[model samples]
Target: MTFDVKKEEKQFYSAKGPELIKIPSMDFMAIRGTGNPNDEGGAYQRAVQTLYAVAYTIRMSEKAGISLPGYEPYVVSPLEGLWWQDGYAGVDLNKKSDFQWWSMIRLPRFASHEILDWAKNTAAEKKKIDTSDIQWFTYDEGLVVQAMHHGPYATEPETVSEMNDFVSDHELKEDFSTRYHHEVYLSDPRKIAPEKMKTILRHPVKK
Candidate 1:
């Protein structure tokens, strides 16, 4: 059976309403870019492509005769992002051009720095795109409040507002000092209607 993070770790991916939870440290294959995500063939789009290329390379390593110690077959985690802007408290949906994003996909436990380097080189060779900027890093997102947002990306502010209310009710404060506003894409916009799309909106919080 294939290991699926969504099913295995339901709490992290599936949120019906705003709730507080603790997240542990996890490894990620990440790429950073600044620009409007809607720009055609732009930096954000290219960064996403690079991330997938490397992720798939690591996923299919066994088929390619690449050895990974203690490897297990699993489904790729959903695309996640850390979004923010300089001198801004939270994201401004209207001003996407000034957005700084860290687009990332979670890696399995077996993935290591050495394996990531190999995957980057192999993906670059296969996809004919520069993957040198892709970086391997670990993130520890401690306490957070998250909810499943239902609707288009542009409408996330509504959900964010609700989350903030919950935060205040619980006597917690949003701490963007060492963390960020995070999002996990659970549905592909290409296949799902904007009104029906699902996204997990998360923000770091502290008491």
Candidate 2:
């Protein structure tokens, strides 16, 4: 059976309250790009396309006789992103056109180094697009305070303030070195209304 990380890894996806979760190290297929996501065919849009090109290549590796141990056909995880700008702890939503972001999709443990390389090469060959910027990233988010934000992405500051209040209440300070700010998009923006979009907001912290 296909191992669905979101369904099996319960703690990673479900959060209705401002709760703290300890997450271990996980590898990701990541690409760093700058500028507004709404820009017409800009870096932000291309980064996402590259991410999926490599992601689907790896997902369909079996067709190429590339078999992996303990592997089963499974759905790809939801799109996730790490947000921040140089020398800034928080991003200015109003200035999204100038925002910098590291867009990534979490790679399962079964996806090995060799498999990732194969996917990169395959994507380049089949799609005839540059996949050089994509790299394997190891992230160890030891302890984080997270909350479920139910609304539009444009109105996320209110939730961030709430998370900050929760963090201070527990005597924990934000750890900027580990990560700037993290978000897991649960709803498809194309299909879901902005008011109904679900995003998991996470902040790295130290006690």
Candidate 3:
């Protein structure tokens, strides 16, 4: 049955706002996006291309009536993504000279195997490369708290700080079992304008 995953009711925590609580360790497929440092335009375009490429593949597969176990797509990014940390997440922004940007699509842990199979093949075909261009992994099952950021990413620290406080108040500690701080992009400030930008910041938390 077709349903709106975005609208799907999920356990949530709200203090300053409603924080969507997603279980960690959901399997996901991602592209290691890199972009031109100076060519913000090119970087953005490429980022959009990569995001749509995978999203379309999943959507088309579902439309064609393909079924498998576990299914959902999340556009994952970093927590302090806008900052440049030299050899770290900052490297992607360095690619701007080459017209590249870093981004990725995170498939839900419950995403169907058939959907993943199709996504792999589809990415290879569209990007003119094989699996090398894509990286697939899984997120472990745990507590993840998320909320939408509606301003420039530079201003996200405040929002994240509040979210952290909320987690702490609720007796939740940061879950550091994983190496990555998960973020899902719901809006592209480069194109959508910051006033309307929406970024979902998710942190692994221990309840």
Q: Estimate each model's TM-score.
A: 0.97, 0.92, 0.60
Residue 175 of model 1 has an lDDT of 94
Instruction: Give the residue spans of candidate 3 off by over 4 A.
Output: 10-24, 33-48, 61-103, 106-115, 126-131
RMSD (CA, angstroms), candidate 3 = 6.2
Candidate number that wins on TM-score, 1 or 3:
1
Give the higher-lDDT candidate: 1 or 3: 1
Tens digit of lDDT per residue, candidate 3, span 96-127?
34322235554553566566667768776867
* Candidate 1 off by > 4 Å: none
TM-score winner among the candidates? 1
Q: Model 2, residue 153: what's the lDDT? A: 87
Whole-model lDDT per candidate? 0.92, 0.85, 0.53
Q: Write the per-residue lDDT of candidate 1 for residues 1-207, one digit (tens) a residue.
A: 789999999989899999999999988999988999999999988898899899999899999887888789989999999999999987777899999999999998678888899889998888898999999868999999999999999999999999999999999999998898999999999899999999999999999
TM-score of 3: 0.60
Q: Which candidate is the best by lDDT?
A: 1
Displacement of the residue 132 alpha carbon in candidate 2, Å: 1.0
